[model samples]
Target: MVRAGLMRIARLRVTLAYGAMLLVVTSALATLDPLARERIVEKASTNLHNLAHGHFGTLLGSAFVVDAGAIAVWLPNLLCLLALAELLWGSTRLVVAFMVGHVGATLLVAAGLIAAVKEGWTSTDITRATDVGVSYGAMAVLGAMTAALPRRWQALWIGWWIGVGAAVVATGGDFTDAGHGLALVLGALVATRFGAPEPWTRWRLGMLAVASWFGFAMVVSTTAALVPATSCGLLCALVGGLASRLSALRTRPTPSATDMVPDFERHALS
Candidate 1:
């Protein structure tokens, strides 16, 4: 019983950490100058003029745009949702999934932004915010859960992805569908890889960390080619990567069927 309680508490801590970070960042941005806030909203929304002021007014009211409209302040919200999802799916698997999904998504978004800028479809003043939602993380969580669920339910994950894709289309402006698709693929791959416990080698963790950081850096550097944006991405990647690696290190070996029976009986008796 004590062990179970401790495990629950640990899961709650991860969820709260993500949520707290979002709250802090959003709250701080809300205190920024009104003009700065407006500029950030403008950069975040491609259809700002078409969408009612109230539609994104709340988000804009709590966001800040930094470094000439290169990076906007909504990361906390995204991270909070991701963390909550991670907690729900158990720390080990979800953390790995989040890292892969986030980095992969960011890279795709950066690529789209770069292409848009080159084609003169979007200005340097605009930052794309379409693919930064928590829906992808939620989808990944659902995907991982499907492994435990009946096989017939496997198609549900695909349906969820399609729904998200449609949502992106409906909200289209400078949205990047490529980013969403890439994230789903990466999330699924990570989920499949980490589904079973394997040897925890420092080299494997280090390689993943390096790749994750490199991808994060590319996203930051390409977004604005500015110091602040790059700095933010670097910091996020470092902290997030460390947390993920630690969780992976702590992953227990998969139990055999015999090992599971006693635990099931104990729980059933309890």
Candidate 2:
């Protein structure tokens, strides 16, 4: 799995790296004027109202544009997670999973938000929210990558994602969080058809670490009187460390059976 991820990174170095480079440049340009930047973000946003008008350019373009603060964070996530999915499921299938998650979650969340607006649950207009970022795609890739990992790693990886995501949303529920949660679920569902997980060979220390962190976060969220921000930060740190350690582990690359069709004629001839 590690070698395969590395190979995918090599294959995507030019595409994703240059794309990240361009995002940095665009982000700098957007920062020059506060109003202009706001307008750009607004237009690039995939809004509930905007979707009704058949505006899909935002779906693809938003992936390329992000706030200056988030550009630093998302660039690495996009490269690492997407590359891993690309290697495991092939670039075409990975792209499909990403788009499926992106569009599906966006539409689903938009519908929910529109319903909220109609029901007067939120005074904030759904049409004006700055909902622009690569988060949807990133979550999708992470979800799909979970299916490609060994079961031990899969449980931990997927668990941390769900736990942290649910904790954050439970504390600060928002449209973006809803979109992220939906994307993860959608990605996992679609990816099952494209790839299978590796068998578990032993106890998964990673799973324990993730479960402990998740339990801590849940306990903090419910039992403690700590500020939400502080608790979330500590939880994020724990999960981030676990993810980094997982990234650094060396795992033997196994061939994906589902990704390749068997050659019956060649086998017969042999």
Candidate 3:
């Protein structure tokens, strides 16, 4: 019994390992004075300047580091999400999907930021903006999970995320949002290797309209950090609701063809 219990726990070794690492990093951060901690976080950021200087450590370190005060929120949320991804994709696939989203999204966002700076669409100071956390990859994994959702839900979920991310960029919301959108795309793309969910239903045309408009509102309202932190915490809470719905439905038997018809479509026909 003991061995069996331990074996089951070991299945989530990746999530556990990550959570442990975060605690260690947070403890060390807490030891420092406020100013010093802030400075260290700034230095540890994988911002454009740090990347330009080729300080690879910052790139790796940023993913594990979070402000001491924020860990309470960060720890639980990430552990839940990461564990879900690990369970679905296995340890190796989860890690690969995450790192790819993190690194790829960071680079893509940075490139876009550089162009914006050059074009004078934004400030140079934005380049020095603090960029850290597991969200980029987390969002990717979240995006990748679209495959597990119902057919119509798969369309709306992915569409809403992409719309929000794109609106953030188009409206100059934040570099973070740009990265988020890209990570979602990257994750979804990679997940296609595992076989995609059913394609979008014709009803998706209506869902696209609903998702795009509301997704814009979700982005503009929070516009700060649409991930799972700081200003984006509200957005994260909404995503939390979505996740709960996803969990409830993940194991549900496929809906009948008639049952799958969206309410709006049925109402329209009526």
lDDT of each: 0.47, 0.64, 0.71
Tens digits of lDDT, candidate 1, 22-113 = 45655665788978756655545423232233344322322222222212433433443444445435666776675565555554656666
The runs of at least 3 residues in candidate 3 whose Cα sits more than 4 Å from the true structure, single-residue gaps closed, are: 167-172, 195-270
Worst 10 residues of 2 by lDDT: 215-224
Q: What is the TM-score of each candidate against the true structure?
A: 0.46, 0.65, 0.70
lDDT for each residue of candidate 3 in 1-270, tens digit (9 for 90 to 100)? 999999868878999999999899898889899899889889988888888888878867888877524677557766766766666667787887888888889889888888998999988898789988777877777777776566556655665565556546655557777777788789888876765333444554444344334333323546353443322434544665677678769978987876788999878877
Q: TM-score: which is higher, 2 or 3?
A: 3
Give per-residue lDDT, candidate 2, residue 41. Answer: 75
Model 1 per-residue lDDT at 228: 44
Q: Once all C-alphas are superposed, what RMSD does model 2 give against the true structure? A: 12.1
Model 2 per-residue lDDT at 259: 33
TM-score for candidate 2: 0.65
lDDT of candidate 2 over 130-213, digit per residue (tens): 777666765676677666666555555555566656666677557777687788878888888885543332333343334334
